[model samples]
Target: MGDAVGRRPAFLLSVVVIAVFGLLSAVANNYGTLLAIRVVVGMGIGGLTIPFDTMAEYLPQTQRGTALLSLSYFWTFGILLVVLSAYVAQQNFRLLLVLCAIPCILSTLVAAWFVPESPRWLLAKGRSAQALDTLRRAAHVNGHPDAVSLFPLGMKLKAEEPEVKSFAVICSPQWGKLFFFLSIVWAGFGLLYYATIMLVTDIFAQDPAERGEADGEGVDIDYEAITMSVVSEFVGLTVVMFTIDRFGRVASQVFTYFSGGICVLLLCLFASADSTSRNLLVVLAFGSRLFMSTGSCVTWTHTAEVLTTEIRTTGHSFVNSMARVTGVISPFIVQGGLPYRTIGVILFIASILTTIASFCLPETRGIALGTAMSQDSTTAKERTGTPNSQEMSQSPATVSDKEVV
Candidate 1:
């Protein structure tokens, strides 16, 4: 994600195309057409998620999660804002797609102007002097002073020459364990997020005969539910940012999945309830998104944080891409069922996968960005028993989601 090659115009153009896919989705005439559009949207999103995670890895550890969390907020805001914009444009249906393209075009312009080159990339290429300058620039972006301590100081480097690690290099035995953890975590992330959003529309669009009228009772229901769902994601990201370091990565992620599971399961009960219960279901669905994303952001940050610099971007790109495979199928799996309980069951499956994966992980609350953990090395043990201290001083503080936001 932080690689210099990723900053080239070609990759940026690909991201723009992804936005175009989402922009055209409303005009899709059939299920097949819409499904194809969504796949395009997912691919674009997959592209975006990687670069952003790489950005976090390139920044200082103290600011890494917060920086990434803020990006998620902007991503949330974009989703929420776009839905609202699309609804307005729907008044003149043909123009809505054009309006959708406006934001993407504008973002492309802005990114070209200000998205800084990755400092970590420069370091990997043996451009140490330039990398140091890039670090100062990043500190300025993060609202820190450009003084001596602006960039982290204790990081040790072993690479003597610039060598680009191939994607296949990612699967070597040393990096494979982290790679597996990221894959499972990202799959669980993709399923929970996409299924819930996809089901929002399906649940509201009951049989045509049973659909609520736009009057007091309305079939504008899908719009209503999806809008709230987007808003809830912003709120979710906010909660994760404040408490992410406090709760520790493992605790935050586990809470998101286990608690999100309980919240989504409430939908099953609500599925059987009266109209008032149905109304409550909307809020519950929104809350479920909140928690799921909360964990997703943390999980992504952890994945980027724990891997050694040699394989960091490879690990990130791999997980983000694999996550899309689950995302492409999740919508159909949930929507194909008659009862919405089917969706609840699928989410429960994702939650369980995430929960089990969380246990296989270690807490990375204060770990520095770009440093790798050695779980099997006894002499390198850090803060194993000190749960209450700021961080164990025995060893120097060591290094170590999500919508693309």
Candidate 2:
């Protein structure tokens, strides 16, 4: 687990990625330009998430869930902004895109100006004096007790003992396990979630040859579709927020994943018929979005909490990046937005990935950040020690003194 100290970089990284995506979107020209920009954008976004998971391990256990939930509210507000724009700002989507970028860039600047470095990272690096100062700042902000209890650990005294590895190390020995699993799971999550939400438009487009037969209002505006988007995007998130607190993390996530899969299969099976299929697809789409959002939101909460504090930003960045990468591809695949039977197949595939990944992850509803990192079993952990013990022992705490050799 990490302390408030460990959470700093991840937050700062998130701010940077958000701004970068804005720049990419602003500059993108063609489909290919947008695609390449998205990949780079995804990686930068991915880099930002490391701190959330890591910070969970650092705080007092009772508050971890609450803190994460509050963090989620920030994300939800971003989504809410999108929903509002889509509903009210009909003609200026491009401007909306640019506006999103502005905040991200501003966020990065604010982080640099105001936010302090993570005390945990300092301790892990063996910068005791610096870490202690950070610790005081954390307590002052949160009104927590002055935690002199920070472990005796420090970064290696020599500094050269455990040099941070390069990307090749992330790939070779680690095989980027964190990155890979997160990518796969996020692929499913993104595809499933977005597909469920957008399937209405897909239905309209797919059956457009029969547009004369598409609507009830006789005007063809497809109000059911517009209404569904609103209900699912804005109203549903607000509704789920309260339930999230009641249901907790694991239960809410799995329930959403399993139910979302069922919703998709139901839509495909029922919508196979012609006449009644359209409206039914709308209803099913709503259901899927609600359930899928429930799962997706919960997963975000879980993932951000489950990783070790030390590597939280790295781990979060990887997963989040994967989600964006998939989002970029999902549209093309689900509707042959490419040349394939993307929708049904992609949904099932996503279902399986989330099911498998969800099972593999450790449950961390109430765990502290410090404990989480000490117990981490990733490449760094086997090389160092468990996350909990490490937090207690002193991390990036002592390089020369605790060198593995």
Candidate 3:
């Protein structure tokens, strides 16, 4: 839908869906009602790729990696805020839901009023006038009105617009290889990321000494452990934000996954030895989280960067959907009473496989976003010294525009 219509509309619709459903969830009377509403909320959440795609398209290539990775700070802070809310609400589920909805509502207003449609999407869809106008507006905002003159008044994509569905285009031979490896990376990260967090929470729950008595009330939630986990995420994001653009996406993922897998292996060893050192377990858990957080951030930014603008949102959403599937299954693995070593082996294998898969993907650190699938195919062939006659014939202006933007 984003690729077909425009990124801004899809983004606005997503925010509205989340805000409306979230508020509705606050008033849900029963568990089933709340669950159904949350499903709709999840659908809204799924469309979040639109905004990420929008940001990726609008930003300059030099700053794109750092900017996109920086967005992860909001996510980390959001988690911290949720934890804080949960602590404050103290079982008042209604208040908690309302509090969560507030951000969605505010974001909806901001997106609707402030955010502009992606000029890249406009150009891809044969709306050059709008695309140029958007660029002019952006240039004006940045106090570079003169740069608007550098943008072509009536730009056209060198590659023809794709007629088939976005999915069909990405599934074609040209993009299929990249998509396949990305899917594996996303699914593995999803499974390992959530599973590690849940496993850590379960471990904390098992140690009653960490859980204080609450008289006749419910068991005290371990907010301290949760805070530590969030802190680890922040630390990981801090490191990746500085290094991702410098090292490139593939290298970042490889490092994080390999290091994280080692942490998981150590966790397995500690569990198998039946070590009673709670502090050691906590440290290992934090270490796993730090790496997982960094790896997941790189995976997301890489996915957005690699796909062509024509299929950016669709391709990203597909890979993210695979992640969502594994995310759902993570709870069962962690809470299913499986032995620690078994869970550790599953995560370790996933991390290592993802690490290997990261090598299969091309690095997309500073490359301008490809407007069409053919551009991507041409680039790939160029890398392999097999550029076709048509790709070799593209005009200098068309090529220069890609680099300039």
Candidate 4:
């Protein structure tokens, strides 16, 4: 949808549609009504990345990775806030749903008033005059009036691009291996991260023995464990925010996944010990959550970086859908009739796969989104022309303005 309609409209549509669905969901009368509303809500959710696409267009190359990763802070914080709200409100889910809609409505208003359409998308769609106008406005907003002239209006380039099966393009010779690797990394990490959270709740639940052993002396539920896990995730986000621009997306992701995998193994080993230490278990869980959050942030940033703009929105949707699939599958592994040790083993394997896949990803540190996309498209063409073509060096970043209209 972003490919055809442009990011700004798609983004606004997402927010407005979601807001509408949120309100409807709150008042849904039956399971069937809620289910129908949620399916429509899911379509709106697919456009969630459109804002990121627009954000990338406006940010400096140096700050782009951090900016992308920072989006997760809003997401993670929102999750924590909602959980706390539910706890405080005595689990009034319907009311909470209504409340969430207000923010989406407000955000839609802000975006409609403030956000400009992406110049790159405009260029892609052969709307150069409008693209230049958009760039000038952006430049004025950024206090760089001189930069406006750098993006000439009506710059022409090849106007014809194919729209094959989006998946086929992603899997063609140029991007196939990289796409596969990212899919594995995304799916595996999502599976383990979500599965671990479910497992932790079960692990820390009140023991039936304690409940039966005394009169009104059952052990208090350690809600602190949940708090600690979320805190660790925030800490992880902070770490990524600082180091991602320095160490680059690939290194940070590899370290997070490898270290996280080790933590998972340690958790399993500690569980098998004759004298299991609760403190140690909690510590390991915290570490795992930290790395998982960090890695997840990196994955989101890197996936955006690696794909060309031509296929970016579609690619994001595809990999994100895969991650969501894992989210669905993970509960079965962790919560469905399975031993705790068996669950740990499953997560350990998933984490290891993620670490390995991270190794296959490219470093996209300071590359401009537009330049990266063009470079990859050029490489794809060259490779198709000659199967043995040596990898082409990245061309000097240039803005072409001379092609025929």
For candidate 3, lDDT tens digit of each residue in 1-405? 788778898888989999999999999999999999999998999888888878887776667788898999998888788889888888799999999999889989988888898877776677767776777777777787585565654444444254234578667888888888888999999998888777767766544343453344554556787689779999999988887756667778888998998897687668556545867876887898899988999888888877777778888888988888999999998888788888888888899899888777776654555532334432433333232343222221223554432
For all candidates in order, the CA lDDT equals 0.65, 0.57, 0.77, 0.72
What lDDT does candidate 2 reach at residue 171?
61
- State the RMSD for candidate 4: 5.6
TM-score of each: 0.80, 0.69, 0.86, 0.82
In candidate 1, how many Å is residue 390 off? 8.1
- Residue lDDT tens for model 1, 268-375: 557645564556868887888888878777777777667655556556767877778888778677767546666687688779888777656655556545443543
Q: How many backbone clashes does candidate 3 have?
A: 0
Q: After superposition, how far is residue 389 of candidate 4 from its true place, in Å?
A: 23
Off by over 4 Å in 4: 145-165, 207-210, 213-221, 268-278, 370-405
lDDT of 2: 0.57
Clashing pairs in 1: 72-405, 213-218, 296-401, 300-401, 368-399, 368-400
Candidate 1 vs candidate 3, TM-score winner: 3
> Lowest-lDDT window of 10 residues in candidate 1?
396-405
Q: Evaluate model 3: give its lDDT.
A: 0.77
lDDT of 4: 0.72
